[model samples]
Target: MLLETTPDTSAFMIAGYTVAFVVMGLYVASLFIRNRNLDRDAEMLKTLFEAESSPSSKKEAGKSAKKPAPKKKSVSKKK
Candidate 1:
């Protein structure tokens, strides 16, 4: 009697590889987007820090650094 053999699994293998590559590409794209956003945030923070550290801001900060002395309150005798 003649016996039937199993079919090839190359199609399944190709499909699995396709899925894996797609997932990897998506992950890489997300990483790139995140990096770009972080770069933009860093630039904004740097500019803000520079602005705050400028001479005018420093002068203002110095002027506001001194606090007015607190006055002592007089207490009255209570019954």
Candidate 2:
């Protein structure tokens, strides 16, 4: 009589591969979403910073444009 070999279990290997692919897909998607959100935040912050700084700079420029009064010369001799 010839001896026959039984096939080994492969379901566990299939399940592990499936889980690994699913997790990697989810991680890539999450990274994409996070990068998009960060880009949006950066744009918003840049606009906000420019909006805040421009007015202050303009006001400072206007104030500095005014002629200042001349100071009188004072001589002090220290012995």
Candidate 3:
């Protein structure tokens, strides 16, 4: 009868787990940073859009309320 012994893989298992945890942590941190940047961009775009549209619309309304200029009459003299 021959007896067989299994090889110990605890170091490899620990290394694998550590690599997985570090990769997962880095991925999560990247996601958080991207989300924060997107939120900031959204807020900036909203403010810029509001500022541009509101003032332009008000100016258009003011222009529309005014009357157009009248045309001048031309006179011709024949001798």
- Over the stretch 9-71, how does candidate 2's per-residue lDDT look in tens digits? 699889999999999999999997777667666655665555555567576664444323222
TM-score of each: 0.57, 0.58, 0.59
Model 3 regions lying over 4 Å from their true place: 1-6, 57-79
- What's the distance in Å from true for residue 44, model 2? 0.6
Error of 1 at 78 (Å): 72
Q: Cα-based RMSD of the predictions, in order?
A: 17.8, 19.0, 21.3
Candidate lDDT values, in order:
0.61, 0.61, 0.62
TM-score, model 3 to reference: 0.59
Residue 3 Cα positional deviation in candidate 1, in Å, after optimal superposition: 4.6
Better of 2 and 3 by TM-score: 3
lDDT of 1: 0.61
Give the alpha carbon lDDT tens digit for every residue of 1-79 in model 1. Answer: 2676777999999999999999999999999777766766665565555555555646666444422222222222221
